[model samples]
Target: MKRIGLTGGIGSGKSTVASLLVAEGAVLVDTDAIARSIAQTGGIAMPAIEAAFGSSVIAPDGSLDRVAMRQLVFTDAGAKTRLEAILHPLIGTETQRQAAAAGDHAVVVFDVPLLVESGRWRTLVDRVLVVDAREETQLQRVMSRSGWAPEAVRAVIAQQAPRKARRAAADAVIYNESLTLAELGTEVRGLWKLWAAATTR
Candidate 1:
């Protein structure tokens, strides 16, 4: 099996691209979804989080209050790192297990929002495929889609790896600006063929 890392900045339509890849028969492992599951109330990462950040991070329903945690982490770099320390290992283990179970002939797509930021997982994949868009587009998309203030969106973007750095690190880039879903799908299909050929070699 070939492990392909798919990444992009927030609101760059990475999920949309991942969906297209799924339609192309790739086995998708969404790290964000896995992290969310592990952070839920009484989830694998909850004990460590509660210990580190206290019970305030937990919701009334016994789930991790994602909004509260997000607010806390965004303000405190150490807290963010602590959270990552707890969750990254679990996410990575599950991702590897799933990829291994996919067997040969499967294209395992690891949809990671922070692939560039994490840096350590580059060796886990055969190639990095980044979905790219202009920063202005990203800000607009984030504001409209998330209903967040422009400043909030900008702050989130500020914390992520810059577009130039991400592009430089990418083995492939999918320009997402001014592209329709059909166009995006076509591009992904083309990349699928390329990835298949490369991995087979």
Candidate 2:
């Protein structure tokens, strides 16, 4: 199987590219989805999360209070490390399990939002595809799509690896700025042909 790592900063339309790849027959193992699954009520990681952050970060429904946790992580430097410590291993294990289960898929894409920050995914995949956009574009897109304040969007961007770093890590990059959906789809299709050909060879 060909393992491809797909990543991009917030508001770069990484998820859209991922979906397009899926439409083109790539089996997607989305780490973000895995993280959510493992953080739900009664999930495998909740006990550890509650133990680390206390009940304040857990909602009444027993699921994680994402907003509270996000605030904490942003305010407390150590909190982000602690949270990653608890979740990364679980995410990695689950990612592997899912990838193993994907039988005969020509391309298996691992959609990891923090691929550059993770420090390990670089060596795990055959290639890294970055969906790139300028910081201003990211700020505008995120604020508009999520109704977040501009500063809030910037804060999230600050926490991620810089655009240059992501670009440097990429084996391929899809510049997602200023493209219409149809144009973006065409771009993904073009990459699909090249990547599919590569895997076969």
**Could you tell me every candidate's TM-score relative to the true structure?**
0.95, 0.97
Candidate with best lDDT: 2
Per-residue lDDT tens digits for candidate 2, residues 1-201, read 899999999999999999999999999999999999999999999999999999999999899999899999989999999999999999989999999999866589999999999899999999999999999999998988999998889889999999999999999999999999999999999999998898767
How much is 12 displaced in model 2, in angstroms? 0.2
- Each candidate's number of clashing pairs is 1, 0
Mind giving the per-residue lDDT tens digits that candidate 1 earns over 71-129?
88889999989988888899888888888888888989999888888887688888999
After best superposition, candidate 2 residue 50: deviation in angstroms?
0.6
Deviation (Å) of 40 in candidate 2? 1.0
Per-model C-alpha lDDT, please? 0.89, 0.94
Residue 131 lDDT in candidate 1:
96
Q: Model 1, stretches more than 4 Å misplaced?
A: none
* Model 1 weakest lDDT span, ten residues long: 40-49
Name every residue pair that clashes in candidate 2: none
